[model samples]
Target chain A: MFQFKYPENFLRALGKPLVVFISRVGELSEFIARALYSCVTPPFYPRLLLKQIINIGFYSLPVVALTTLFAGMVIALQTHAGFSSYGAESAIATVVLISVTRELAPAFAGLMVAGRIGAAMAAEIGTMRVTEQIDALSTLSTDPYKYLVAPRLLAGVIVLPLLVVIGDIIGIFGGYLVAVYQLDFNPANYINATVNELQLIDITTGVIKAAVFGFVIALMGCYNGYKSKGGAQGVGEATTNAVVTSSILILILNYVITGLIFTE
Target chain B: MNQENNKIEVSELYKAFGRKRVLNGVNLSLKKGESLVVIGGSGTGKSVLIKCIQGLIEPDKGSIKIDGFETVGTPRKDCEKYYATMGMLFQGGALFDSLSVWENVAFGLIENQKMPKKQAKEKAIEVLRQVGLGADVADLSPSEISGGMQKRVGLARAIATKPEVIFFDEPTTGLDPIMADVINDLIISSVKKLGAAALTITHDMASARKIADKIAMLYQGKIIWQGTVEEMDKSDNPYVRQFISGSAKGPIKVEI
Candidate 1:
């Protein structure tokens, strides 16, 4: 074994990451369950949860809406140009409709929402941890998770789906506008075509996908924030992790969900 | 003494961070309405010890009896009932910036007690006044205040619910000596006024003598010396002498 020279130092460094990984897993698991538990638990902090719902969920709307709209337009243009050479231009409506609703809308919406609200949650709680308010809250007879993490996760899971569903609708409309007005498709026919082309399964699958992505974003955000240690640098790392992990998880999960749903 | 009625008991405690041990077989008692100051060098687990008792950092092995109810590994739900009796002034004032000073002070009362805002604000003003801040200052933001003022607000918030116990983490570390003494005097008087048990963590000896009825010097994860303030000057422990006098050349060498 090559453990003679650097043994102790290697063990110490290795222990931190292992503990960190385990701690993060515990935090995420607890938050997900507790958010569900607190729903039926008496003495619900409804006012506090409402405030968080507004802050983390509703406030992210304008950005998610705008980003989805623009993304939908770009996808439309890209599909139009590519399909033209293959003489498959007539199928552009179905292509844009499926891709935007099932994939782009949910994926980009999750990523954007994750980057915005996820970073803010991590930074806020991370700062609180470093500053010792989390400890202070404990001394004051409050559960920091119940008081802080629960509401945020509750709002994220409950609200992001609605936001993404709205985004899916808005994104499809964006494609329609580009298709009808600029791409020279008939306006009424474009609208009718989009509706006819999109099966209920496509729309339902996208909404379900958005819900899963929402869970991923909230889980990553709360986990990073709850386990945040050290000071400014640690908070920065948690915020960065919230964004990176949520985005990656959203992409990866999208593929899995798509395979399961579309294949069946 | 009637003050001893307010004491917390610790017994046969052992804690370690992996192979590097901290809190090796520690035991002590802090009396009611009495102030105990825990002083130690940097990295000596002074904060860790306090955190352990408060249930922030769980100890590997120990018994912490708060007013006689043992707190070792108590379920967090039950811990909330225990927490209702404690308050803390963090190393840096941890006032929530999103709220006004009064709101920060009223956080617990409103959230936990479900007290209405008007009643909480009225009570918050009373506590703020007790800490020497006027009612007019209660509306200002925590960031808008000076460091000393923030500490005062933090102190006010700690005593707001009138908890039976309070912990001060480095209350005087960042202040000028004059301000530090002011904080020390405020802490002493407020603890006396509330008749609350106080446990303050610091390496500041000057503040220790002024605020603590008992002094415990922690080093290498253990309370190496514990005595009444008067007895500390006569104690012959080399580590205690070196730590109290601020001498660089001693048994306690800086890692540098």
Candidate 2:
């Protein structure tokens, strides 16, 4: 009898989670729509925008720089080792240039920032929610969406591309340093190879990816925090969820965007 | 009895969290410049009632009227102007930790009223002084202050706009006896001074007696009894008597 019900039970268990996931997606889409609507409406807050830009962009530089730099160096070393075995070691510069601009730098910087800034945004907003500070804003006649969410969304869209551009340059410089100093490649030749391999498409793709990743990071952070309940435990869960969801979304979206952009 | 004289009029309010049924068919009203206190035990939906009035939480079914204007289902934009005339002090003070004490107080003036920063700061300082907080404490962060001081700052912030109506949620929940009395006094003086229609929700009977022109006891999502403080002393209702005397064994059962 139990064996006969096994498939039905399995389907039921799957159905519940599928329903939950779909509803969550719906809620998130509505949240994003409202945030975007607030973005386009009047009563913008430049001061808050500037503050968020500083917090999300300027403050994230060290981690982005360090992560991309190390990633680039490691990619250079690994490619060199692989290609040296086949006597194609000179291709190291080309590989480093393409990978840094097209994939590694943006993804690494996004993931790093997701961990740092996403968690912070969730924690801060969750605290505000539980403490009734968000309600206070409403009673004070300030729109919390316009004041909190819009500034963050706009700042993320504005500044992530800038951060990624800087990250790209720093990452390439890391590759250059390793090729010239550690790998015994001539500095001028390596530079020439890197310049020749770099493409407009490569740079543009990274910039676009960075922008989407930024939006995802900010969105997950704000959504989780704003919806958080209970208390300290709720905030803690929200922060963790923000970081995890944004990081996963960064990776998944990277692949999706890459596929879409590169498709014929 | 006069609808025109009522500052707030709520009728048949219903709110439920899932199947919990937090508030059921509630009705109440506050007259102009009158301080009405809602008393209830834990989990009794007093906060929900106050939040529903503030437009922070939309009730499932109800009519909430401010100055005879129906507010339920009104668009936030249509109601924006009304918020300018209203103020709230949250249970936990709810001061924005990111902002300094003065900025917290002056938030409504600078943001909603578009007053200049310097003028708002001066106003905040003056309001802070009124709350018995010194001007020196204005520049400090809310975290640097004690719980009592933070409550005072919250009160100052609530009254900074000189609102026509004010709501306080658990105004004296976390304070010592002396500090609670001080807050009770501040609340009384502030409401009197502003001549604002005030609604406060708290379980603290002492604070309620000190501040309320009318006291209503909330039980299981309904106002079971309402009367003046003097009348409350002589009420025959078992719930009212039990609550007033703070008796554990009574018609009101502790959930535990």
TM-scores of chain A, one for each prediction: 0.87, 0.93
* Candidate 1 displacement at residue B249 in angstroms: 1.9
Please give, for residues A29-124, the per-residue lDDT of candidate 1 as tens digits.
776787667555665667777887787668888988898898888888998999889987777777778888888888888888888988988898
Give the per-residue lDDT of model 2 (tens digit) for A151-228: 998888888899999989998889888988999999999998888887899999999999999999999999999999
All candidates: CA RMSD in angstroms? 3.4, 2.4
The candidate scoring highest on DockQ is 2
Candidates' chain B TM-scores in the order shown: 0.94, 0.99
Which stretches of model 2 miss by more than 4 angstroms? Answer: A1-19
Which residue pairs collide in model 2, if any?
none
- Supply the DockQ value of model 2: 0.86
What's the lDDT of the predicted structure labeled candidate 1?
A: 0.83
